[model samples]
Target chain A: MSPFLLLLRLRLMEVFRVRFTGFFFLGLPLLFFALVGVIFSSGHPFAHRRVVMVATAADENRSSEMLVAMARFTEIRVERAATHEAAMGKLRAQIVNAVVEPLSDGSGYRLIVGGFDELFGRGLVTALPGHVELAVAPLERWGFVHYAFAGMLVFCVAISGLFGMGYNMVRYRQNLFLRKLSTTRLSKSTFVAAQIAGRGIWSLVQVLLLLALAHLLFSLPLSLVAALWTLGLTVLGLCAFLGIGFLLACFIRTEGLIYDAISSIAWPIVLLSEFFFPADELPSPLRFAAAALPSTQLVRLLRAVLLYGETDVASLLPGIAIILVWIVMTFTMGRFFFRWND
Target chain B: MGFGDQDALLLKVVIAAARLTKRFGSVVALENVSFQIEGPQLICILGPNGAGKTTLLDLLEGLSQPDAGEIRLFGTPLSARRYPRERVGVVLQKEFILDGITVGEYAELFATIQGVKGAQQILSQARLQDRAKTPLSKISNGESQRLFIAAAAVHHPELLFLDEPTAHLDPGAKLEVGRLLTEMSSEHTVVMTTHDLREADTLSDHVLFLVDGKLKAEGAPATLIDSIPPAARGHGTLEEAFFHFCAARLTARGDIEPVRP
Candidate 1:
C-alpha cells in the first residue's frame, strides 16, 4: 500500500476499536428517530403514490403554484389532462388517484377524488385548499420516520466528523505523536490526507448503513437515486464538518478543550437545523437564519430529493455551495494555523 | 519516496552551523552558537538543565529555525519547516508512542512513511521482535525509546539527532540504549544531548559543552582534559571537565547582578 493508504488503514483500525463507534453511527440515530416518533404521534397511515390529475379548465398559473405546493408531499405525483373527460378516463381506469376540477363558485380548484383509493382520496378532498397540512396525510406511519431520520443523519455527520477526526487528532497532538511523526519522511499533508480520507471512507459506510436501516427497520421507501442523493449530501456535509474538526485540532492544545468546543459548536447546529422543526415554516428572520446554516440546508436538500422527489440542480445550489465553501475555508484556515508544538 | 529533497547527500560536510540563535517569547534558549561535525562518529552535547542543548538539536534537525544565523546539513541550507526527512532521523528524549497500535504496527508505520522496507527486521534489531504484537500502551518506557531509535534509523539517515534518549531509563536499560546509539554512530554521524556524565564519557568520540545558551568548551576528550585549568587537574577527566567549566561559569556569574531572565 501507499503511505497515505497505509496510514489511513491503521487510523481506521485504531478508531474502530473504540467502544460504541458502530453504535454511534447506527443505533443512536434510530433511537433519536424513535423518540421523535413518540413525540409527534399523529401520522398518515396509508403511504403510497398519490397520483393527482389536473382538469384542463382549471386556472393556469394558480394551478401550477398549487401543484408545486402539493408536490411537497412525498406521496403526491401530479399529472395533467387535455380535457375533463380525458382526466376522468385516467381516474376511472385507476391510473390517477384524484383530479382537481374548477369549483362551481370558482374560488379555487376543487378535489374530485376517486379510484382504487377512493375513501382515502375522498378524505384528501375535504382536507384540501386552505388546510394543506393534510399534504402529508398519506404519509401516515412514515411521517416521523422520514423527518427524524433526516435529522439524525445530519446530527451523525456533524458528530462523527468533529469528534472522530478533530478531537482524536488533538489528542494525538497533545500526546506528541504528531511531533514524533514529523521527524520521519512523512509530510504534514500526507498525515492530514490520511486522516481525512480515512474518516471519509467511514462516512460512506455510515451513510449506507443508515439508509439501509431506514429501509429495513422502518419500511421507509428506498429508491436507488434517492439513496444516492442522501449519501452524497451526507458525505459532503461530513467533509465540511470534518474541516471544522480539523480546524479545531490545528489550534487547540488540549483534548478536554477540544471536546468542549466540539460539543458547543455541534449542538447549536443541530438545534437550528431542520433536525427539530421545519425551518421554512418558522417566521422570516428565524427561517432566514436557519436557511443560511449549512446544517439546515444539508438536511433540507437531502429531504427534498429523498422524500419530496425534487431533482432540480438549481434548488440544491445554496446548500452545496455553502458546504463547498466550508470545506475550502475550514481546511485553509486549519492549514494556515496548524503547527507541530515541538 | 521522501518528504524533503535529499540533495545534501552530494556534499561531503556532515553539518555546518554558524552563530545559531533561538528564542521562545522573551527567553533566549540558544545564543550565537557555532560548530561543525565532520565524519561518522558520536558527538555529545553536554549541558545542565536550561543549557540550550535541545535547542541546538532542534536547529540541526531543521525542526526550528535560528532566530539569527544559519545551519547546513550535509552542505544544504537547513529549513525551519524541516523536510527531506530521509537524510535526518530524530529520537526525542521522551518517547512519543501512540496507544492502541501494536509495536510492530508502530514500527511499520514509521518505516513505511520513511520509505524503507523490512520493519520486522528493524524491530528485531531493537530487540522488540518478541513484543511486536504488544500494544504500545502496555510496553515499558525504556522499550518504547529503543523502538523509536530503531524505527528512525530504518532509512539509514546521513545525520541522526538524539535528544537525551537515555534520560529516564534504569541503568541496564540506559546501557542498552547507550549501546544502540554506539552502534548507530559507526554507520552515521550522530549528535546526542545528555546530562549523564558516565554515558557522555563512554559514548562520545567528541564533546561540545554548553552553559546558559552559550558554547563554553568543545574538543576531543583528551584535548578537553588537557584544557582543564591546573587547579582542576585529576578531577576525574570529563566529569571534572564539566565541573571545571561549570564552576568557572558560576564564579564568573557571581560578579554580575541577578536579573529575572
Candidate 2:
C-alpha cells in the first residue's frame, strides 16, 4: 500500500482499538440522544402548572370539573383566591406561584402567572384557558431533545476530532512514535494528512449512523438534503475541532493535562452556548460570547437545517465564515507551535 | 598513502560533523564537537549523566539541528532535501511502545513506512517471532527492547544511532542485545551511548569520551588508556583513565587544586 494509505489505515485501526475513543467519540452521543430524546418526548398534560389560584364562582359548583382536574397534579398547590387583585397580590408576595381566573364564557379557567419569568410562569401561561381538556403536546416539532440532539451531534464531531486526531498526536509524541516516524522517509505532512483523513472518514460514519438511528427511533425528519447538510457541517466541525485539539496538543505535555485542558475549554463553550437550554435569556455580553464560539455556530447551523428544514445556503454564510476563520486560525497556531519532541 | 587508499578512505567516511554547537536556553548541550565515523564499526559514546551524549545522537540522526554547525551523511549535507533517511535508524533511551499494537504489526508499520519488506526477517533476527502476535503491553521489557532493535534495523539502515539502548535492560538482556548489535556492526555503522564502561569495552571498536558537553577524548580504548598518567593507572584500570580526563579539565580550569606528593 501507499505510505499515506497505510498510515490512514493504521490510524483508524488504532482508534477502533482504543476503548475510550469508541465509547466517548462515537457511542456516547447516540446514548445521550436516546436518553434525552425519551425524557423530552414524554411530556405531561399538567406539567405546565406547579402552583395556581382558583377564582371560584359565587355558586362554586360551576367549575367543579376544572377544579378537580387541577387537583389531579400532585406537584401543584391550588387554592381559592377571591379576586384578580388578591391573586396578583399573592403572586407579588411570592405566596402563590400563579393565578387561575375563571373565564366569563365558561370555556375554561384562564391562567394568570404574574412576572412571567420562571419556567413555572411560562408553563402556566402555555396551558391556560383549556386546563380541563388540554393535553400536553406529544412532541414539539422542534422540541428540547431536537435541540439537544443537534448539539450532541456537533459535540460528537468535536470529541472525535480532538481525541481521535489531536490526542493521538500527543500520545505519539510522548511515546516517541513521532520521532521514530520522523527518521523514516515518511513526510510529516503526509502523516498529518493521514490523521485528518482517518478522522474525517470516521466522522462521516458517525453522521450516517446517528441520522439513521434518529430517523428510525424518534422519527426525526431525516431527508437526503438533511443528511447532506449534516455531513458537510460535520466535516467542517471536525476541521475546526481538530485544529483546536492540535493547538492544545502542541503545548500540553502530559496525557492528564490534555484531558483537563480540553474539558475546561469544551465544556464551558458548550454550556455557555445554550446547548442544554436557551441562551437567549442570558446576559447580552455572555450571549454574544456564546454566539462567537465555533461550536455554537455549528449547533445553530445544524439545528436550522435539521429542525426547520432551512435550505438557504446564503443564510448560513456567517456561521460558515466563523467556523472557517476558527479553522484557519487554529490550524496556523497548531502548525506554528508544533514541536516533534515536545 | 596511495590515491586508491585515499579514495577508499573517502568512500568509507559515512558520517562527518564539524564544530557542532547546540544549546538549550542557558545551558550548553554540545559545544564545538566534531567527529567522523567510517563504515562497519561500533562506536560507543561514553559520558556522565547530562553529558550531552543523547543530544549528540539526536543531532546525528537528524532528530534535531545544531545551533551552528554542519553534518554530512553519505557525503551529502544534512540540510539537503535528499539527505539519506532510509539509510539511518535510531533507538531512543526510553522504551517507546505503540501500546495496542502487536510486535509483528509494529514491525510491519515501520517496514511499510521505510518501504522495506523485511518485517518477518527482522523479528526473527531479534528472536521475537514467537512473541510477534503478542500485544506490546503484554511483552517483557527485554522483548520490547529487542523489538526496538528489530524495528530500527528492519530496513537494514547503513548507520544506526542508539541512545542508551541497553541501560535499563537486565544483564542477560543487555548481553543478548550486545550480541545482536555486535553482529549488526559487521555491516552497519552503530553508534550508542552507555554509562557502563565494561559494556563499552565489550561492544565498541572506537570510543568517543565526553564530559560536560565537550569531547574530552576520542580513539580506540587502548589509545585513551595510553593517555592516562602512569601514576593514575595504579588507582584502577579504565575507570581511572576516564576520571583522569575529567579531573584534567577541572584542574585546568582551576576548580580544584592539584594534590602534592
Candidate 3:
C-alpha cells in the first residue's frame, strides 16, 4: 500500500475505534433530522388565530349578519350579549377575537376589539370595509423546527471539533505520539492529509446515517442528489472545524489547557452563530461576528440545500467562500504552530 | 590525515556537524559544537540533564534545524526544507502510540516506511515476535523501546540515532537492548545519548561526552577512564571517570552547581 493510504487507513480506524466518535458523526445528525421532521409535521394549532364572535340586543339580525361575515373571514365562535355592558364584559375577558356592537340608529355597527386573538382581528379589519379599523397585537410565526435543526447541526460540528480533532491531537501530543511520528519518514503534510481524510470519511458516514433515518422515520424530503450535496457540505464543514481544532491543539501544551481553550472557542461559536434564530433578528454586532464563523455559514448552507432546495452555484457562493477561507486559515495555522518538541 | 584529505579518509561519514549552535532567544542550548561519525560504529553520547543532549539529537535526527551551523549527511548538506530519509534512522526519546495499531502492525508500518520487505524478520530481530498481536499500549515499556529500534533498523539504514533508548527498561531488558544495539552496529552506525555511563561503557565503541553543550571529551571508554585523576578513577568504571571530569570542568569555570542528580 502507498504511505498516504496506509496512514489514512490507520487514522480512519482510529476514528472508528472511539464509540462516542461514531455518535458525534452519525447519531447526533440522525437525531437532529428526526426531531426536525417530527416538529415540522406536527403543526401547532395556536399558529392560526380563531375568529371572535360579538352579540348585542339592539339589532340581533345585524349582529348575527356581522358574525357570519367575520366567520367567513376568520375562525369565529359566536356568542350572545344582552346589552353593550355585556359585550364590554366579554371584550374585557378576551372571550372572542372582536365584538360587533349595533348602533341605536341601526344604520351601521361598531366592532369592539379584544386582545384574545390579534391575528384574527387584523384579518377581520382588512377584509371588512374602511369603516372597520384593526387594533392588532402583533404575533410572530413560530419557526422552532428550523431553529432546532440548525442548533443541532451547530452542536454536531462543535462536538466533532472538540472531541474528534482537538482532544485527540492533545492526547497524542501528551503521549509523545506526535514526536515519535515526527521521527519517521512521514512528512507533516502527509500526516495532516491522513487526518483530514479520516475525519472526512467519518463525517460522510454520519451524514448518510442521518439522511437515512430522516427519510425512514421522520419523512424528511431528502432527495438522492440533495443527500449527496449535504454529505459533501458536511464533510467540508467537518474538515474546516477539525482544522481549527488542530490549530488550537498546537498552541496549548497540556491536555487541560487544550480542553479549556477548545471549549471556550467552541461554545461561543455555538451561541453567537445564531443557529437557534434567524440572523436578521440577532443583535447587529452579533450577526456580523457570526457571519465570520464557519458554523454559521455551514448551518446556512445546510438549511438552504436541505430545507429550501437551493442548489445553484450562485446561491452557494458565500457559504462556500467562507468555508474555504476557514479551511485555509486553520490549516496554515495548524502547520505553522504545530511542534514536536514540547 | 591532513585536513585536506579528511573527506578521502572517511568511508561514508553519514553525519558531520560544524560550528552548530542553537539559542532559544538568549539561553544557549548548544554553542559552536562540532562532531562527525562515520558509518558502521556504535557511538554513545553521555551528558547530564540540561546538557543540550536532546537539542543535538534533534538536529541530527532531522526533527529540527539549528540556528547557525552546517550539517552534512551522506555527503549532502542538511536543512529543514529537505529531509533525506534513506540514510538515517532515529528512535526519538518518546514512544509514538500510533492509535488503532497493534505491535506487529506498527512494526510492519515502520518496515514499509524503511522500504523493507519481510517485516516478520525485523520483528524477530527485535525479539518482539511473540508480542506481535499485542496492542502498542499493551506492550511493556522495554518491549516498546525494542519495537522502536526494530522499526528504525528495518530498512538497514546507514546511521541510526536513538535518544535514551533504555530509560524505561529494567536491568534485564536494558542488557537485551544493549546486545541488540551492539549487534546492529556491525552493519549500521548507531548514535545514542544516555545518562547511564555503564550502558555507554558496555555498548559503545567510542564515547562523546558533553559538558554544558560543549564536547568535553571523546575517546574509547577505557582510555578515557585511565586518563582521569588517579584518586578519582576507580576499577575502570566510566561513571567514576565521568564525575571526575564534570567536577574538574565545573571548578575550571568557577561555578559551584552540583552535577545533575
DockQ of 3: 0.40
**Candidate 1 residue lDDT tens string, A58-167:** 46766677677667776665666545655553344343466675554656665655434557666665655553222211323554566678788888888989987789
TM-score, candidate 1, is 0.77
**lDDT measured at residue B31 in model 2 versus the true structure, 0 to 100:** 93
- Every model's DockQ, to 2 decimals? 0.52, 0.46, 0.40
**Candidate 2: segments with Cα more than 4 A from true spot:** A1-142, A277-284, B1-12, B79-83, B225-261
Best by TM-score: 1
Candidate 3 per-residue lDDT, tens place, A3-76, comes to 99999999888646755555555665675556444433424323333333445454667766776665564334
Best by DockQ: 1
How do all models score by TM-score? 0.77, 0.70, 0.72
Q: Alpha carbon lDDT of residue B1, candidate 1? A: 16
What is candidate 2's lDDT per residue for B110-224, written digit by digit as tens?
A: 7888888988886898788888888988987777887888788888899998989887789998999999899999999999998777788888888887878888777877777
Cα lDDT tens digits, model 3, B103-172, are 8898888887666784797689878888889888888887888888988887777889999999868999
List model 2 lDDT by residue over A1-342, tens digit each: 999999999987864675655555676567556644443442432233334455555727755655676676666756665455545434443334566666677766655554443456556556433543222212333344555778789888878878876688888888888877777788766787788889999899988998887777766767799889989999998999888888888887767557755765665666655566544434456668878888889987887677656657997889999999999999888777877674
Root-mean-square deviation of every model: 11.2, 14.7, 14.8
How close to the true structure is residue A92 of candidate 3, measured as C-alpha lDDT?
40
